[model samples]
Target: MRTRITTIAATVMLTAAAIAHAGNVGISAGDYYSPTLATTLTAQGNSVHAVGWYNDNVLSTYDVYIQDGSSFADAAALDRFVYHGGTLIQLPWSFTNIAYTADTTVFSRRRRGTLEQLNPGIDVIAPDDWLLAGVTLPEAGTQTIGREIGNRFADGATPVLEWEDGTALLGYRRYGAGLVVGFDVHLVTADASPLSADWSNRIIGNAISPVPELSTWAMLATGATMLLLRRRRPD
Candidate 1:
């Protein structure tokens, strides 16, 4: 009976994953390879690629860029990309305060905390947010995250999920016409626990799609920029 129920649950989860946003996604893969993270997004019908290197020219191709525990040396390029309407997901070791990089240096240091093992382990702080769609506290409550990245959320950062102790588990902030998200959950190894994998993948799926209003505005802004560049072209 237990196995039957688990199978049903897995089917439901996979169905949800399948319906998620289908767009171009790039995951960091220079120094490290994050198979779980890559596979989860790919399952959502996205064209997932490993971004072994980056620059403004290369960054413009993808709709969303995910830094998965690899060193992203081009902060300025990332900033420019986000400003011009590209989504950014900072997972685990790629911690950074997108809107206010100077205000929170500690976040860049990347501190680690002990395992989270308790009832309601993953709290949905912003239940109404899209990031928690199809996710319930009961399903995620008992899952253990072996090591979590400690974060001091930047000003203007909104918390979508939290740890039992009130640390931000997942948060995001809009920058220019784009969005920047930070995750305490380890996407690289979230599959270590079935519940954790489900929870993290749901949040990431929502993020890549983003809210329609913001995404629309981003598209408009990018279009306007292109038009302006074309107008300035030498005849």
Candidate 2:
């Protein structure tokens, strides 16, 4: 039987870093691969911004907001933009206040959590959710993606990927025309990793671009997988 957990308010252990600071950790010099990730977004044709927290105009201009801060001079403006139809990708503890807010209307609900390490576990994507197109999940259990959050679920929120512990590694919630996606996996921590770099690229790419499906591509993928598995199996 599969065990699933709902968002609950209680006591739990948090990551040393998270506990040390419940504040926004914006893109810094240490986030070595962040620039590469940004480059990928641009290559995939996304209008990426570093998110000017004080400027309301910035929020309205971009379709996707990559928040690296918590306090905003015009937070209401940002919320309104997302409330209407703007995609907000909240990175791990980027906006600490918003990240732990109990408001189900937004993404973060729980104020506490523990770290979960999954080595490219099974990632389930909903049919027709094209933001994650052309992205291949990790099949080999070598490299790991760390999600430093516990179970977080709310009405109208869809689970993009679930960790082994049944917590949402990635999740989305409907606000209006736009949506909010919470990513707990700290993919931006390192600078150089072949598999993780490509994976993060596509994940953000889909978030920025439309991932409409191609019938031919789908068939080819299915056929290829079957053929590869069949060849590897014992006769």
Candidate 3:
């Protein structure tokens, strides 16, 4: 009875996997903006990883934001908060205060050569504590991307912004598997137009393939043993 149950379960799982792989689903969160945007992951089977990218330029200083709900209605819902140097901070769901200053010394030290010279004439607003360049899975499931702001900087800088024809990589892990999503916004200059573009749609079609599940190997071994036993029986 136990063997029969296991066989039935495995068969069901295989059928589900076949159906999931046969029809792929994709999601996109049009452009980069403040507040959290929520979307679904399709073609990921029972378990799947998700990755995404944004133009670093969209963030004035260094901050990140995520989607709050399945739609754009609850865009202001606060999720996870991060600092310019990649430090995680805490924010209340209704919190809205976003003010900060750059560490001139650290900023200057990090900014050498062209970056230092390019600092002038550009507006660099320190991102709120609740922001991130990208998000990950597992962690993101509980957390969210906060608000995002794109700023204009001089060209030829080492780290470019998201709205400047750049790319940001965001990935997530699901069910011991990995999923990666990339956003490529080809904007010639720094502007909000790119933020309005449906970059997320482009991302859904570009999901990373999943790896083989461990159960597959176990099933293969079982099949091999059954074949050997049948051969030895020799009718």
Best TM-score among the predictions, by candidate number? 1
lDDT of 3 by residue, 104-218 (tens): 1001111111101111111113221011212111221221222212222222212211321122122221111211111212111133222222333223322222223557646
How does model 1 fare in lDDT? 0.64
Query: Candidate 1, clashing residue pairs?
Result: none
lDDT of each structure? 0.64, 0.50, 0.25
- lDDT per residue for candidate 2 within 112-197, as digits (tens), equals 43333445465575634564567666664645554445545566777777655555656677666766776655542344332245
Whose TM-score is higher: candidate 1's or candidate 2's? 1
Error of 3 at 47 (Å): 18
Worst 10 residues of 2 by lDDT: 1-10
For model 2, the superposed segments whose C-alpha errors exceed 4 Å read 1-33, 69-75, 95-120, 123-128, 188-196, 212-235
TM per prediction: 0.68, 0.61, 0.23
Write one digit per residue (lDDT tens) for candidate 1, span 1-235: 4454455545544554444453888888753336666776777778988887889989899889887664655777777778888888777655532322542121333565444454346666677886676765535444555434456666677878766665667778778877788776652235343223676677788788743344554554555555556766899
Ranking by lDDT: 1, 2, 3
